[model samples]
Target: MNIYAHFSSIIARHLAALVAAGELPAGLEGYGFTVEPPRDPSHGDLATNVAMVLAKPAGSNPRAIADKLAGLLRAEPDVTAVDVAGPGFINIRLRDDFIRARVPEILREGTDYGNSALGSGQKFNVEYVSANPTGPMHVGHCRGAVFGDALATLLVKAGYDVTREYYINDAGGQVDVLARSAFLRYREALGEDIGEIPQGFYPGDYLKDVGLALVAVFGRTIRAMDEAEWLPIVREFAIEAMMKMIRDDLLALGIKHDVFFSERSLHTDGRVQDALDALKAKGLIYTGVLEPPKGKTPEDWEPRPQTLFKATEFGDDVDRPVQKSDGSWTYFAGDMAYHYDKIQRGFSHMIDVFGADHGGYVKRMQAVVKALSGGEADLDVKIIQLVKLWKNGEPFKMSKRSGSFVTLRDVVDEVGKGVVRFIMLTRKNDAPLDFDFAKVTEQSRDNPVFYVQYAHARVMSVMRKAAEALPGVDLSDAALAGADLGRLIDGSEIALVKMLAYWPKLIESAAVAHEPHRVAFYLYDLASEFHGLWNKGNEDPSLRFLIDGDKDVTLARLALIRAVAVTVASGLAVLGVEPLDEMH
Candidate 1:
């Protein structure tokens, strides 16, 4: 149960009653009223600023309103004490039994304890790792992939209908380069000695398998064909093979997208034209000259008029070109069409996760969506920063030309999926992350993944030991629901329960901010609390889970540990990292 929400609703109802009874003025909005844990535990179990928020509107002093609200709240069976704190803040101390009672509710809810409906069932589209399909994914793509997936899972927990999508850049010059690169590999597969990769061509050996497959399928059939004739066939084959590799690599890290949007499909069967027509109908699309871009305009730039969108009208720094002088659509043109298609498919909330190098593109993209939807659609672009690799305290270098670039598969293979996923998300998306192969694999407290997973594993160990020692003591809901949690009275025991109380609030806040790293940090804090309690038990016999002679006390303590385990499991699941039951 969400205790904060429960108390806020009760306080709001009482205030509304007061307003109706003429004790407080009408038309004073109470939407800003909130119930949150006090900074100091001694102050109260919860605090609310309702009196302060309503004071000016009600034509009353904050302290006066707080005193009146305090009296009203003190009458409730759950509220044991209420004090008017500094300048109208009301501090509430709930009956000890009220807080104790939540233990059973948590046991009943299990892993679903902190699930919330904060999103109100809104439909959201999350596009991440839309990395170009020219080659296998590298370490740089890992963070966004994990972050976006976890964010989608968090949104789902917050009751949003989330669609995880990957936009494939398959219709640009990059793809054409990919086609030519594959052709070289195709020649190499036919025993032709193609020397060092030519300039502007991909030099990785990842396409070797694709070329081998091409030889097996085409079997010299395209030898007599011109580049134009062979280009399409080879490009399609290479793209499919590369995407398969990408999907497999993502799978290795336990990531899967619900949708894979192909940029090429936007231009297929006139879809791009249709999208442009829709924008044109709204008078957002126009053919006009764009002024030379400020700050480092190309020296060879000529002031020729080109077709441009009025992006500046929607808050972009400058109007952006849709078509270039070569009569080809710019990259931004395809992106606009893609987003418009997403809007047409009924997603009013859209999120695009891009690399930090694309930071300058965020405003323009948001402008496009705003202009296209007439401000109805909301677009949030999260730019994930670069990942600096280190191994054994030395900078890890991966160069494609030297054939040493660390592929996604390499990292996954070295550390396994769980470590990779957890470590990737341990940092904020926009902050540069230093991922050391040595540090992450270490089973120490400093390693967050290890610490968190160790907490889960420790809980399981306690359960196993308890089950063996106390035969027939039910760990099931029916039994745990009847737990006498008042038996858990130690300071550390109560502190652990209080930490559990923050799960709902943490979930709501993290989801609201669209920050999955917050979840990672929360899990770290919770793990720290669990570890502290576990360490304390080593010193204080009463704090231990197995109170050797008392079944009720043992069961109560087990119930608390189980609650912690459930919350940890739920948080890790949201991050798509498997909760370990045993640490090896």
Candidate 2:
């Protein structure tokens, strides 16, 4: 059970009672407040802002409301004490027995302990790492891939029916360059001496495999066709090959998408025209000339009259064009159709994960979702910042396989997949991250990945020692939960249990915020607490997890540490990371 949510309900009940007793004004049910841990643990266990929230509405000072609320809260069976702090905040300390009861609940649930039902199984779509189908994924795409995957996992844990999607940008000019690059490789494969790769074309030797594959399929016959006939076939073939490479890279990091939506399919199926017609029916489509944007003009900017979408009606800064002067659909038009298709598929909530470079694309895309869905759907875009790679205090080398940038495989190969995934989430999505090759792999407390995993491994080590020290004892979680937990009177032990009890509430907050980095931060803090308690045991034998010839206290301590292990494992699972039983 989520203790914070539990207390929130209790507070709401007391407020309702105050209204019924005529002590406070009516219609105060909608007051916004928070029931969370106090900033200073010594103040109390949990703090609430309800009195401050209801002060103005109740026509009284905050301290007066707090006194009335505190009086009612003190009568609760589980509340040890309640006090008014500062102007009006209520601080509550829960009974030790009440907090200890969560231990069995956690043991019974194991990794499923913190799962929440906040989403109510709503259909949610998360589109991320939709890199172009040109070559292998680079290190630049690694952060978004990991962030999106972790976010999708977090949403699923929050009980949402989520779809992890990847949109293949196969219809853009970049794929045409990929096909031409492969064509050059094909010529070289057939004993034709192709000169240096032309400027503005992909010069990566990675396309050599695509070239050789084409030769294996059609042999010399593909060479007979002209550019027009061969370009389409080559483009299709190249796109497929590149997607396979991209999929393999994702698989190395244990990521797989439910849908690989193609931009080409939207255009080929006439969905692009259908979406524009739908907008026209709503009177949001028009033909007009757009003024040159402020600052520098983009190469594709034009001042001529063109088909446009009335984006300003839905909160975009300005109207955006849907069709260009040459009568071709703009990139924005294809994106609009894609979202229109998503809405038709019954996803009312959508999230897009983009790199920092696409920060400007957020508003326009959100406007498209709002306009197309008639405001029935909502879209959230997360922008991931850049990751700077360093090695031995110097910049890391690039990969020749991916033309000039570091491939995702290079990073994954140097550090294991778990290290790569865990380290990527150590920062907020909008903040810059520095990834050091030596630091991330080091086996020290300074490395968050090792520190958190070591905490779990340390608990497992204690369990192993308990097995040998106290032979023939029932040590399973089920058996330990039935132990006499009243012996857990130590303050440090109770504090650890309280941390475990906070897991469910933490999951809900992180999922709602669309921030998976919070889980990483929480794991580090949890590890520190566990390690600190372990050190205290070395100084005082009474605080040790296993006591000589006292099975009751030993069992209680085992139950406590086991819950810590379960909680750490649960959090790591949410971040798409694995918890190790023993560290090398």
Candidate 3:
């Protein structure tokens, strides 16, 4: 029951009637208007700006159009009142009984209540957590991992065919450093006195296990090879081991990707050159000398001709380099081939979740998709901000096991997976978040995860008490839905129903904006409303879910609370959070 959509269609019909009657200008369909909940609830249940939106186009006064539209809405079913406010805003109020009647519909839908068909089965690719395959995943990667996973789940719920992917940065120079680090461990395993790790080497003890494994497989044969011969072999072995550790760590957090694309494969199979050749065909490839970058000059800056792509022709600030002066493919060339591969695989929409440090890379990547697909495809990039670690309000130190950064496993092992996932989403993707160990685990209303979970658990507790207090009373959802809901005359009861009805619209808007943190904010507000109603019953004994010797009233209140539970559970599922049935 999408109440917002229902009213929107009604308003559209009335506007069409005015257009046919010659009271308003024709071609009113071109005007874009919005139907949404009013910021102040006392204004009305739903408000529309259709009259204001069409006033300029139709060459008529806004209030006059609003007055005519209000009269038409007043004759509709269940619309009790319509008011034309300042500047021709139409606020429509529905009958309270009409809102109460939606409880049964919510009970039947359960967790599927807020499901939407906004995407209409369009294929979408969400690429995130593409961390370098050189060591274990750090706490910085945790934010992007959870954000991407939850966003993918939200798109799926909104009816998009989503593919969660992880891109491996194995072809970079970082992996070569990892290979050299593992070689040091390999020498130490062979009973040699390996001194302190040099300036550029990784110093984590985790590589000691990799060294031992290499000895088990290649034995003494690797010792006789030169640096050039052993670099590639050790690089391959080290990358595979590090990726396994990464996969295990992600599994601990309940994150699994559908695709793990290798950057090295793009170079090995000639896709990089193939992508450049395709650009050359479009006349976008050329030899040009770029000016010095903004601010200071780079160390490798030189005034020479380089192969470049016409990135500025699309939307980027300047043209980008596709090949360096040394006749080697640049990093941007690999990215173009990767996206071309995605375009070939039939994805019209793509979302990239990047770290905070990659802010400068957004414009060029978007330009690449637009140029390559000839405006047939679109790309959206979300930059995830950093997460600060705190223990009882003091900054936490880094983990020695990870050499320099705190591993994702250390955070998950300290608190469970659900807590980490929920807390990470409490802030928007572009805003920095502070994850404190002391505050998140506290059993209080200040803790949003616990507050929301307690609301679900409290409803379950109420059901248990209903079974004991009123024996053979049929406390199931079906029986509750069939109860005399007219007995629910309180303002709080009707407010909850309105909140529950807004779930479908919330899902649609959040999915459209590609913002998943809105779900966390909505859940917190819903839980607060439910908790407020529960506390109201504490003062007035008659407002409680279970009233002595009053079966009809008790069942009516039970239906109201059960509807709240269903909506909360449905929202949590979209955020990849499990609603708790009991608090420990």
TM-score of 1: 0.96
Q: Write down the TM-score of every candidate.
A: 0.96, 0.97, 0.97
Residue 534 of model 1 has an lDDT of 89
Candidate 1, 147-206: lDDT as tens digits: 899999999998899999999999988988989999999899999999998999888888
Compared with the true structure, what per-residue lDDT tens digits does model 2 show for residues 1-584? 99999999999999999899999989898888899999999988999999999899888899999999899999999999999999899999999999999998899999998999989999999999999999999887999999999999999999999999999999888988888888889998998989888998888888888889999998988899998899999999999999999999999998999999999999999999999999999999999988878884677575698999999888889899999978999999999999999999999999999999999888899998998999999999999999999998998886668777889999999999999999999999999999999899898889999999999999999999999998898899999889788999989889988888889988999999999999999999999999989999999989999999898999999999999999999999988888999998
lDDT score for candidate 1 against the true structure: 0.87
Candidate that scores best on lDDT: 2
Please identify model 1 stretches exceeding 4 Å from their true place: 55-60, 297-300, 398-404
Residue clash pairs of candidate 2? none
C-alpha lDDT score of every prediction, in listed order: 0.87, 0.93, 0.92
Candidate 1, position 451, lDDT: 92
